[model samples]
Target: MPDFSKLYDDLKRARDEIKLKIHLGSKDAQDEWAELERRWATFENKAELERSAKDVSDAVKILGSELKDAFQRVRKAL
Candidate 1:
């Protein structure tokens, strides 16, 4: 699974950074941020299992990648 702890930490850092800037972004970005937050929660739960099992599920990988990309888009929007 390539040590998803690193991936989780990196994503958490990015998400935190964006959260501080989101207030200054547009309504659309804020809405997207909200949706991403939901996904993040879902990811967090599955990520732990995957991290522990050392077996990366396709769903978690896709969701994590999606969150990363979405966070980048929101940051650019901001």
Candidate 2:
């Protein structure tokens, strides 16, 4: 099993740090933040499902991949 907790924390920390540096008044920044929020929500929802999951479903596998991709994108953005 992967260490989802650590990935989640790292992505969140990166997002928060970037949030502090960007101007809220900028539409571009707000759009970027919105994308981050969307990714975070998806990742968090999947993580919750993973906790209660018995067998690893195809959907879960896809979600895991997506979350990892999102994390990488955010990391690169930072």
> In lDDT terms, which candidate is top?
1
Candidate 2: residue 35 Cα off by (Å): 2.2
- lDDT string for model 1 (1-78, tens) is 455778999999999999999999999999999999999999999987776665446668888999999999999999
TM-score of 1: 0.61
TM per candidate comes to 0.61, 0.51
Q: Evaluate model 2: give its lDDT.
A: 0.81
Model 1: lDDT to the true structure: 0.90
- Give the CA lDDT, 0 to 100, for residue 70 in model 2: 100
* lDDT at position 10, candidate 1: 93
For every model in order, what is the number of clashing pairs? Answer: 0, 0
Model 2 TM-score?
0.51
At residue 8, give the lDDT of candidate 2. 71
Error of 2 at 69 (Å): 43
The reply for model 2, stretches above 4 Å from the true place, is: 54-78
